[model samples]
Target: MKSNRVSTRGILVTLCADESRVGMPGRAAPQGKLTGIGVKPIGEVQWQLLYRWLYGVVELLSGEHFMLEMSHLDSLCFEAFLQTFAQTYPHQLHLIQVDTCLST
Candidate 1:
């Protein structure tokens, strides 16, 4: 009997970015001080399984916000993040089949 197996030729990729304020109650809250960028598989299961391998974080001062403005260093970090994503591509592709059709 022939072996049943599938090879992973390619995988789905996704990129994400967001910013939020972080500070203790006593300390002054900086606007958009924390930012993160990451790449991961499209599905929730895969993302949860391996999110650490593809992400970057940056701390910015009050003057910086991701889209409206970005420092030169921030741009470099973003470039590095893209490079990391390309370098750390997933090794395996997960396939899922769903059956939700109802017969009339």
Candidate 2:
């Protein structure tokens, strides 16, 4: 925008995005404790019975949201998501809002 002229587009979009890469329920973190009368958990292993992964975002301007279930958290998944999003949105811009910290 110039000093004397203001410019706007037809539709400018922003998004608040997030992802969850857990396979099964209660697998990302332990939901309960396994205590047995002062028993130690030295040799215990947390089972990651995984299944599905998800990436999601909500459009801040429209309150609309989209969720995609992908394989896992890797560059391949991210690239694929970018391709799909570009194909669907077509030159639209987005801002993901995960872990957003602003310092002065």
Best by lDDT: 2
The whole-model C-alpha lDDT of candidate 1 against the native structure comes to 0.31
Using TM-score, give the best candidate's number.
Answer: 2
Give the residue spans of candidate 2 off by over 4 A: 1-9, 22-48, 97-104
All candidates' TM-scores? 0.25, 0.54
Each prediction's number of clashing residue pairs: 0, 2
Score each candidate by Cα lDDT: 0.31, 0.60
Clash total of candidate 1: 0
Error of 2 at 14 (Å): 0.8
lDDT of 2 by residue, 50-103 (tens): 566687777665557767889876668766876776666654555556644231
Query: What's model 1's lDDT at 79?
Result: 59
Which parts of model 1 are misplaced by more than 4 Å? 1-10, 19-73, 90-104
